[model samples]
Target: MILLLLILTLLSLSRGRPNSSIVNHSTQLLRRLGVKRVPFQFDPYKEGLYYTNLDQNLRQVILNARNWTQISTLSNIDFIRAHNVELGRMQQTIPASSRFPCNLSQTRSPDVASHISRLRPGDIDIVAAFGDSTIAGTGIMALGFWDLMVEYRGFAYTGDGIESWRTVLTLPNILKLYNPNLYGYAVAHSLSADVKRSRLNVAEPMLYLLDLPFQVHVLIDRLHKDPKVNIHVGPNDICSELCYWHDLEAFLRLEERQLYASFRLLRDNVPRLLINFIIQPDIDDVMNVFSEMPDDCTTKASFFCNCHGKYKQEKYYNVAKRFFDMQKSIASLPELQRDDFAIVTHEIFKNVSNLWSRNGALDKRFMANDCIHYSQLAHAVLAKLLWNNMLNQTDFTLSEARRRPFEYFLCPNADRQFLRTTGDRF
Candidate 1:
């Protein structure tokens, strides 16, 4: 009776002809069980279409399958072994020698820059970040679906200060090689943002463009209370992700007004600050990468940009482009470019699609299990890109950055001193 029920379920689920060997085996089993014929006729054309959709749904189910009790009861050793495997995989692509070189005996500038424009990499004392999950370091070290929820803040590309650039290449880690006393970067995994470990990385997961102002306020408040912080000569390194979502012009206009007001607040409260505004990649390019991913991965990624469909993608792309242009315009505003404060827009990720493909197939190694967030290797590469962009290196491109046997960008002879630049001015 149980076998009969199981066979009936399989037949109902696959209403089309059995083309695969597994399906043929099932048909043979049904015959041995005294089942005369299938309840419905099979259509060859529909079989192809039906199985395609069924395969996708089954993949999603399999991807999401996890033993919750086992995951909850996992030992520290289990996690360590998993992380080791992941680290080993990443090292296979990016070796330890490719990590940014560190100079432990390096010294800070004798005279810290009183003006933001004159600040060097070693001059930065405080590092803070805001925006979305990318800045917060979501899923950078994830090995599975369960791990994807864990925010490995220390692995973030922007303001992470982990062991060293060798273990995890991040902007803050690279800067630490110059300034050992650099403060405010998240050190380890944090289940929530309202924890002591979260530090100055106030970025939240799944946050929209409009939520940036709130994050700015939170960061400002934290900075004021921290006793170790001295805002006078201590230049703050602020990294922010400003990606677009809404299509309405009014929405963009409102965001601009709020962001401008937030900048004004920062300028009024915090002096000697260098804000790095990271512009996201093109929406069409992101969608193209999604299209190349497995069906389950694409379905998961769609939630991030559900507003963008086959017909509406162009509109979203235009809006995102406009938002990026707005950021550039805002950065160039004379009123905002004071000696004490400066906002520099980094367009390194504007064409990130170059890194998503290799040999005409989606590079799964560069993406997390969810296929939404970047993998650790991807973060390491982006760190190099950001560093190169800040140094105003024109030769380094995204395509070259993602190449195998990864190579760190060499500092130009004239700019080898780790001095910071707006990339637009000296």
Candidate 2:
């Protein structure tokens, strides 16, 4: 019987058919392995589409299109919207509920010492930061902007943090040396990017730098305790900038399901977590609405994805609201924020925008050509956020701030340099 089943499964699989034999084999594999599903098939729903089939649209939209209407109303065959945004009432500012993050800062203060101190001295620690490219550190560029990299907390958003392929990214993640003033080694960090991007800058390397510190903390903690624990995940989640193109309903259902599942998995396993949710931080994100949507799409509020990416990103931010709610649900016990949890997000992006605005920063190492990601300033922002968190928890005192590792710099003067009309020469 098993032999017959195996033969039939091979026959079906070979024919590229979704027949009973193939389904049964996959089903059997799932059952035998005691797993609900496997993601080997890009579209787990067997929807007959995959990422390999979804690349061209990105270029057409980013490189060719002149406006939002051209990009949003795609023609011809279908492609999935990787994200969804609701085109609701356009306000001048983001709703207050959507602006400030939950009062985690207030609630967790009392329990920090108690919870952090209770953890086993040497138990490994893990911190995970997930989201789009801002999470990936694709900041400032050398060809156009230099000092621009000093925005997204510095290097925290650029490379994949892996030491492998060097793709000469838009935001070149090179070390700016003070001793030599410019003699740092060419860091052979990994993660290659293709030049075919709409521009020279590779897309944001999300899920990379954001996960490192916590992972390192966990690794070091385990080195002193146990040598076999890993921490933090990368920016490989199925997030994208063009998700606004999908039919709002379908886009949202898929997004909610995926996010819900992702959060649920973390909730189930890791009680102590740090998250850096990266939705666009623009004044426009709050004020814009796209009423020119399809007639049947009556749920304008639910599918808020319109392309006012700058100064307005309402469609982009609504997603953040949901992520936080999910956190509140999972950490319902109330004490998780003290020792085992935290979240860092892009607040006041407009403030950081001009700092590295056009990506032609004075700091050549900043801004990836992709108009996102980071160099140094980006890393600085991340470190600052975490550093401030530790401060809030009293994990480290003011005097000990020097011992805490993270490079922070807010360049108010970089505006002139970033917007320099002069030729590019960092």
Candidate 3:
């Protein structure tokens, strides 16, 4: 009877096709080993179509037009606009809740020790700065922004504490750097870029960057502690200029889903797990610093120009605006709208970049040789801005006098040394 059943199963699998012999033999072999063939369907739902039921006239509307001005016309499509409007009306009807109480008077005081000591078992306070080289501090990791944030408690001299990538460190991991047990996490890389290649700096491919298994491997190495992750990178997404706007929009939507899944996994494993994201600096504003530099096109063979070349400043501006819009859309996502999931805005960095542009200080002095990364002075200013933003978001205030640029640097000597060493050479 068992032999007969095996023969019947083999015949069913074969269907007498050209490759029936191979199929029948494989099925019979599996049956002999008691391996049942279980058939399953892998079907995924498709994303809802936006203008599926629209009339021909409305269907002709190009919702996602290339230029910002064209996008405003009635011909442009807005799939989410309806949803956003509905949400806005609902918000008006609901009572406002203050998850973050503005405690302007409560500054970072002598009670720092108590704050550091307040961590109970299973309590997690992670500051995972995820982004491109800016968050990584690239070559500045040893003497860069992270060190500066940790060095200044009262503005004297303090040594650098734990490295940012250490997974298993102590708790009370707020802004303080001296806590030997405290942990820090970095999910950033200097060359971390956007989804396509279109005349932008191409170091790593976007598909690889977004690959689940690969990201799990990279992130797990540093983020295994299940800490609250903070992402501060996005400008690189549009660094290619005038390329991949659709790609950027799609990437963010997919990323929102991935982040929600990743955060859920962490939340299940860690206590009070949170995720924060900082909007990137306006690339157009920063690019203006490079744009105004004198063009040095000596020859037609000169393929590259260091801020001194004929480049479309408006293209960079448009891309930056679109990038900011994409970020705002992602932040407004329901999954990322939780109290634990916060978004630090772009106003502070935007202001600083604008200051540099207006003062004609966007020269080589403020940036590295590549004219991309920040100089030591620039880093100091940018770090203080970030520090202040964090302080405000957490409802921790500082007396205006305490917020000096020099106070943030842990070792100004080391920073200067690193800058000098990498100056015009990097």
TM-scores for candidates 1 onward, in order: 0.72, 0.37, 0.43
lDDT agreement of model 2 with the native? 0.27
Name the top TM-score candidate: 1
Query: What do the candidate models score in CA lDDT, each in turn?
Result: 0.55, 0.27, 0.30
lDDT of 1 by residue, 126-180 (tens): 7877766777666666666666665666777776676677667777777777677
Error of 3 at 261 (Å): 6.0
Tens digits of per-residue lDDT, candidate 3, 1-426, equal 000000000011111112334224434433543434432335332221111222222312321111122212213223322332333210111123421112222222333223222222123223333333443333221122222111111110111113221211111212333222333322112122111100011111112112222232233333332343322143444443224334445655554454344334333433333333445555555455554544431221122222222235555445446655655465445553332332323344454344444344444344433344443334444444443433333111332222233333222121221111101121
- Residue 334 in candidate 1 has what lDDT? 81
Clashes in each model (backbone N, CA, C under 3 Å)? 0, 70, 4
Clashing pairs in model 3, backbone N/Cα/C closer than 3 A: 63-76, 63-77, 133-190, 170-181
Better of 2 and 3 by TM-score: 3
lDDT of 3: 0.30
Q: In model 1, how large is the Cα lDDT of residue 162? A: 67
Report model 2's TM-score to 2 decimal places: 0.37
Stretches > 4 Å off in candidate 1: 1-107, 192-194, 232-247, 310-315, 394-398, 403-408, 412-420, 423-426
What TM-score, to 2 decimals, does candidate 3 have? 0.43
